[model samples]
Target: MSLDLTLCPDCGAPAEVEWRAVMESTDGPVEHARVRCLRGHWYLLPVASLAGPGCRLAQSPTSFRE
Candidate 1:
């Protein structure tokens, strides 16, 4: 994983990534991260946004079931 930092939308605290994976979405495969902030706020964030410019989702051989 990249050494990128995500901020909590609610408290503006630094958020920690708990889990990350590419999931199937209506638009196609999208990378998402489960994150929690120092303030204990939890939320889901799109990996692409945190990945910086020119970031792309890698294709995963393993499929995920909802």
Candidate 2:
């Protein structure tokens, strides 16, 4: 399992990745991650999960509004 570095909005702590999915998009491939922070704040974050690209996660252009 990998760690999602997104800090909780309510608290300052790294979040835990619960699940991940890669979807094909017109822009390219996008990865969605379901995370829960140390404070138990749950949210969905769009990140670049592509391997051998960058060491850090990049936010998606379109936020997961749903």
Each prediction's whole-model lDDT (CA): 0.61, 0.55
Query: Which residue pairs clash in candidate 1?
Result: none
lDDT of 2 at 52: 20
Question: Model 2: which ten-residue window has the lowest total lDDT?
Answer: 49-58
RMSD of each: 11.3, 10.3
Across 1-66, the per-residue lDDT of candidate 2 in tens digits comes to 434355444554555567888877799888887877767788765754322223223242122222
Q: Show model 1 residue runs off by greater than 4 Å.
A: 1-4, 51-66
Residue 49 lDDT, candidate 1, scale 0-100 = 57
Writing each residue's lDDT as its tens digit, candidate 1 over 1-66 gives: 553456565766566667888999899999899878778888787776553432221122121111
Query: Candidate 1 at 52: error in angstroms?
Result: 5.3
Cα lDDT of model 2 overall?
A: 0.55
* Candidate 1 RMSD to the real structure: 11.3
